[model samples]
Target: MADPVKHYQSEGHDALSAISQAQRIAFAPMLFQASWCLREIGVLAYLEDRGKEGATTAEIASHCAIGEYGAGVLLDMGLGGGLCHLVGDHYVLGKVGKYLQNDPMTRVNMDFTQHVCYQPLAHLLDAIRAGKPEGLQVFNPEWATIYPHLDALPEPARASWFAFDHFYSDWAFQQAQEHVLGYAPRTLYDVGGNTGKWALSCAARDPELEVTILDLPEQLALAQPRIEAAGMTARVTGHGVNMLDAEGPLPGEADIWWMSQFLDCFSHAQIVVILKRIRQHMKPGARVCILELFWDRQSFEAASFSLNATSLYFTAIANGNSRFYHSKEMYQCLREAGFHVEAEHEIPGPGHTLLVARPLPQPS
Candidate 1:
């Protein structure tokens, strides 16, 4: 195998560059909070509306209904952070600022961080030391995993969590549908199907297709209704079970077993268990499709960076044992679970990779 580092693009840095990078790292939290404040306080919105003409500090303060001093402080921070540009006495939204205001992905990510990650992230070191989700205490004290107690999360946080979860995967569904349909499967089992989005999509694609969702009870409550709302209740059904339970029974004979952005929520050992369970239940020649964002397989440095950063979130809150897997790690898990990669498909947009694996024949 070629050196994985060969693909990494490096910016040749001088002493000044190193100093600049160090300063950015040291002040990142402050910059992030300031930018969030700028967006929440209406500074970015007002500037975005103004366009090239921009808005004066006093005008922004009056429009946003805040004191001019506070407004000025945030505006200065925005200017420093490159979120906005200062032209004479007026401020205009920068490229980054416009994204913060208009991008759906940005909105969801920011809200998710604010609601689900921020407080818990503070305890990340503790979580790492304990090898458990120490930060999950912020949401539910009894549950170790976030999925089990998702419904109990405080109002907007719950809303933000689902929105964040769906927004990332929904875009990839259109691409995934084509891959799954190519095999002409009559029955599709959606493991970890949170809100039945994929099931609804499949129902529309093939009316006669039987779609079953396997997830926790709390998740099914949200999914069953959406399936009905999509008028897919006849074709789509929910089966409540914990995928993480090693000894749990799994329904068999599905032609296609699909897991979208789901396996990354587990450790390597757990992934093997889940895959082995699926293999045991699946019919002969059945295919298991795994859709995930593998850090090493990403086309860009930023995508890999974002994924690596998210792995910390898993350590601190999600499961405390899972991470964004490298493609090699996933392959090893598949091999250990008595499966071989039949095909690998790289999906467009946001660096998602799909692995289609087939179960090895069991000995007589």
Candidate 2:
């Protein structure tokens, strides 16, 4: 594999270019908001429909039901941000504008950032100083993290949060399911199984397979209805327990333990503690499968950039201590928890890495 560090090893831009980049960063929030408004207000879509012919500022404003001045200002920012281009007096949708208007990934990311992270990020420095998710006060001052309040989050916030959470993992689930089912495990434990989506999917694939969801009580409550709706209540069950609580009981008979994009929600020290707790209860010869998007293992620099930016969400909103991790840090945590990695598989599409591990042999 090519060294990921090569991307960041040198300053690639001259001073003039560097200053231009810095200025862009300074006004990035304004550009992002302008781009979002253009898409949401139908300006980009109207431009897209106009195609090569494009549309004049008055025509766009009339079609989108906004003032011509408002349209012109946003269009000017869009041009500067590379979201649109001006042809004489007309504006046409650029590649970036088209992406913002129609790309599923971009749409999901934009909404997630807007509804979930944007306002909370204002408290990022406070979160850093307090070593807690201080920004969570944007919703409720008493809540420690966003997980418990996920279902309670208002309309687009809840929708966007789940969409963002599931988008990357959902794409990789098919390949991951096939890989895990290869072991023919009768019982699979899905740690951090929010709403039991993975559990339902796996149960549907294998009739005899019994799946258990281990998560918070609230999440289990949400999953119960879905399990009954799927008519898999018999095959799928919930175990309400917080992984953060060391004293929480973990079932010992499962053939495989699955944690999908779960461990990264925890601090390194917390991860080791959680893993060590699971190590004590895992049955002999059982496998633990961890699926995560390690920033360093990404095939593209853009994927790395997205993952790194997401780390701030964890800090300011989700949980102050945890961030998307590197593969090496996870490996170290596994080893510290008395387990060893037996295999690593890179799930195609979403750039997720699955690490399969087993407990270290007991001393003779």
Candidate 3:
């Protein structure tokens, strides 16, 4: 089928524009199904424990509970999708998918996104505009889900710390601690941390500090296995906490409060309230560190585009907002929460700023 949307934009290179536009319009419908098929077939082949040794589409269909016709259809399209390879009449994972056969590094990512991300991404645009009052319903299709899920966020934050997880973080830990706080504080807490990657890094480098994570039952169920595997169980521990309720206070006051890629799910007032609550749990020298997208007057184009597209997705499915806030604008909010904002650094590509906020001492 010829694409109705052509290379009308003159800004991009002709070759790139023509190919990009055509691909966009060409597989528009398949966008929703593509991930599912790739994941499904990949899992099926893995279940057979066939590494390089392939399986027929009929066998894959039977194992995956999909019809032979459906399996055939997936193979027909998935080959070009870079998800599978065709061996005459038989089908197997392609070069791209060979990684998924038994590699924990490969399969873990697909599972994480399919189970954890697919739902929220289903409504990424909806989350951006909710502005805090309307929360994203990722786990629950009907009810509002927050806090515990928010706690487990750090692992994904860690996994996604860098741009390489292709579509995904050791840096969230480094940024959460060193870059965000700059060693000005003594203790740090990563609320909703998943695998405790941030804390592991923080504790490894700074032996003087203590870090904590709070998350939900389900996320913890998944995170527990990973945390144990990572073997940082001594430095990092989990506390059962829920943020949606009115009474989920910090277990103790700390020198710093860290919310990695957190705080985007609430309204402005909600952010103020959360900060104020942190104020109650904070010591005189406490600090707040946030790793999020911080925009400025002279905006970077790549950062702008990623934020725009992602915010839209947040709004559509999650009924939440990304809140691409400016520096002074964020400082205003921090001031209202009784904190003094410090420096903000913006790296290249859909940038995330390491923002540090030092707490205000008592007034005379």
**In lDDT terms, which candidate is top?**
2
Over all chains combined, what TM-score does candidate 3 have?
0.57
Clash count for candidate 2 is 0
CA-lDDT, candidates in order? 0.88, 0.92, 0.57
lDDT tens readout by residue for model 3, 1-364: 1221232224565887789779967784474366456565555455336546677877787777788887777666767666676666667667665554555544554554444455566454445444431334544445444333444344554343223222323434443455644655466677656556666667667766666776556556655675677676776667666554446766765676777655654546667777777777777666677766644422544444445444443454333543556556667778888877765665433355667777676698
TM-score: model 1 vs. ground truth: 0.94
- What TM-score fits each model? 0.94, 0.98, 0.57
Q: Give the CA lDDT, 0 to 100, for residue 37 in model 1.
A: 90
Put down candidate 1 lDDT per residue, 286-357, tens digits, no spaces. 899999998888777767777888898899999899999989999999999999999999897877889999
Evaluate candidate 3 by giving its C-alpha RMSD to the native, one decimal: 8.5
Candidate with best TM-score: 2
TM-score-wise, the better of 1 and 3 is: 1
For all candidates, the clash counts are 0, 0, 34
Worst 10 residues of 2 by lDDT: 1-10
